[model samples]
Target: REIERDALRARLRSHTGSRAELAAQLGISERSLYRKLRSLDRPD
Candidate 1:
């Protein structure tokens, strides 16, 4: 799950400009996408 978190963070970091678009393409809600990102940076 942590690896999944990292992957999503990297994707968000590298693809900053197109997040909402990418999130749309990925078939997930923007809020859900952001929640995944928070998980990566949050304290364990």
Candidate 2:
């Protein structure tokens, strides 16, 4: 799960778009996206 989340984050960051826009494209809420990113920032 962590690896996949990291990959998804990398793929999203690779493109040029607003976070809100990217979240929408990913079918998630902006808040949820932010939460996911925040969680990903933590060392496992």
lDDT, candidate 1, 1-44, per-residue tens: 97877777677667757668868966899898888767777788
Give, for candidate 1, the lowest lDDT window spanning 10 residues.
9-18
Report residue 37 deviation for candidate 1 (angstroms): 1.6
RMSD (Cα, Å) of model 1? 1.8
Clash total of candidate 2: 0
Q: Please list the residue runs of candidate 2 whose C-alpha ends up more than 4 Å from where it truly belongs after superposition.
A: none
- Rate residue 14 of model 2 by lDDT: 92
Clashes of each: 0, 0
Candidate 1's error at 15, in angstroms?
1.1
